[model samples]
Target: MTSASFHPTITLPASLCEQAAQHLEQAVQRAVDGAAAPWRAFRRAESSDYTLSVSVVEQAAASLLVLAAESAQSMRPSALRALISVALHLRDAADATRRPTFTTTLW
Candidate 1:
């Protein structure tokens, strides 16, 4: 049996590379913060208001998707603009689908 592996390479201007790096860092930080937020809330989830607690948790998770869309938009790489747009649309759809409702279904 034979297996194949591929490595891809891309080159961009120094400034663009720097911008992309910054955007990536920001996106990672946002993701980390978004994840931490819900954990923090969960730790203090003894609140009397169940509705507010659920709302906060939902918002925190949704924030990760929003950050991804914003990060892609911020990078604005011409070559990947369309792909980014599609990703943003998908993220939005996911956020919409995850909207808080009376019925909570776990799959």
Candidate 2:
């Protein structure tokens, strides 16, 4: 329950941070313009496009982490670290979803 349990600070290059921000911005625009439906289907229980959803989530998480790193100057170090950790977790979760699973087997 203490702040001491937060993840260690992470460092990212300025160029990468800029790229991440740009990618995130483009993704947002795509969603708003109806050019992307990954997120919408992701929220539905009957969604069949798991691959697209996972890919989008992974990219978004990476972009969030980069943006969080870029905001270090304006935010508390501890809070920023927490945000980065959360983004990392989200990215990992998206990666986990990509693993192959057995849905049916002929016996």
Best by lDDT: 2
Error of 1 at 4 (Å): 2.3
Of the candidates shown, which would achieve the greatest TM-score relative to the real structure?
Answer: 2
Residue 2 accuracy (lDDT) in model 1: 36
lDDT of 1 by residue, 1-107 (tens): 33334322222234332333343344456664554544444334334222223344344435444555666555557634643443343344335545667667777
Candidate 1 weakest lDDT stretch, 10 residues: 4-13
Clashing pairs in 1: none
Of candidate 2, the 10-residue stretch with the lowest lDDT total is 41-50
TM-score of 1: 0.30
For candidate 2, the clash count comes to: 0
Question: Could you tell me which residue pairs clash in candidate 2?
Answer: none
- Against the hidden reference, what TM-scores do the models get? 0.30, 0.43
- Residue 20 in candidate 1 has what lDDT? 31
